[model samples]
Target: MTDSRDVVRRLREGFAWRDTPVGVFADLSGWWRDPELLRMLGPSLAGLHADASPTVVAGIETRGLVLGPLAALPLGVGFVEVRKEYRVAGEGQRDGADPMLRAGTPPGYQDGGLTLIAPRRLFRPGDRVLLVDEWIETGAQASAVRRMVDEAGADWAGVAVIVAACPPEVGERLGVKALVTDDQLPG
Candidate 1:
């Protein structure tokens, strides 16, 4: 079993903490380079879906880009990237992604969410998908993507996150499972 507290410890050690105008933020660039963390978290997150047997794993842009692939590998499933506006070349649909998440730009993270445009064909009827993200704050992104999945006629197995700060109602409504919670963050 993945000790959820261990994952919290890894996150506290690997991520740099800060307070912004919006709220507390943790920079995850260093977390990506920490092999110990990658090793610890991948299977932990994938384990969240071990029983459901998801056919595809979908992740949001930026943070999810890394964690999603890692989780998918353990599950032995294909990975799909849910990207920011126009990030993916060729044909894709808009799912109203977070306008605050501008990669390689100042203030790279956003607390307030936006509608993201994702690929039109990420799923098919009866496709079981597990949505992955590094964190779940307001649950807006996950909720929006869940709507997309429903519209696509795909089964939303559930949402998995490394850490979550959303309220209990959000998690219940979105069917989210996380390794750690906002209250678990170490000082």
Candidate 2:
């Protein structure tokens, strides 16, 4: 087993900050490229909530899509995707034929709200779901996901993330577990 500290150190080593026209953005490409880091990520995050014995892992679209399965595979649970409602050029917001559970997020660090949707059938009543994501900056999306879980009558097992950059209160409220805190990142 890899030491938790070692995993965190490796993650930090792989993380970088890139400046774009908009502003500084976190570049986590290094984390995805490192083979050892990839192997460790799932188990490390899942270990945090092993006691919870989550029945399923739910990942938000984008980065969460990658991390969710990694965590779920070790936990012996299935994975579910929570996608953002997207608008195509010709069509408006896209909605599939399958019934979806949707929730609107509060304004987050990005200063924009999004609608998170997932197939209603994926979640069942009494299921314990653990959400896995790369980062939690405002807990807005996480909060929305929690609401969706509630709508499905499933229990929230809590959240596991690579980094916890949200406020202390938010972290406490959401039951967040993380490999590293914001302050631990390179300046």
How many clashes in each structure?
9, 0
Task: Spell out the clash pairs found in candidate 1.
Answer: 94-117, 95-116, 95-117, 95-118, 96-115, 96-116, 96-117, 97-115, 97-116
- What local distance difference test score does each model get? 0.76, 0.91
For candidate 2, lDDT tens digit of each residue in 1-187? 7589889889889999999999998999999999999999999999989899999999998999999999999999999999887632243435665678998887653577888889898999999999999999889999999999999999999999999999999998999999999789897
**Top-scoring candidate (lDDT):** 2
Clashing pairs in 2: none
Model 1: per-residue Cα lDDT over 13-111, one tens digit each = 776778899888787767788787788777899997778888888898888888888899889888877766545546533578332222221232364
* Candidate 2 runs further than 4 Å off: 87-96, 107-109
**Deviation (Å) of 117 in candidate 2:** 0.4
Candidate 1 Cα deviation (angstroms), residue 94? 15
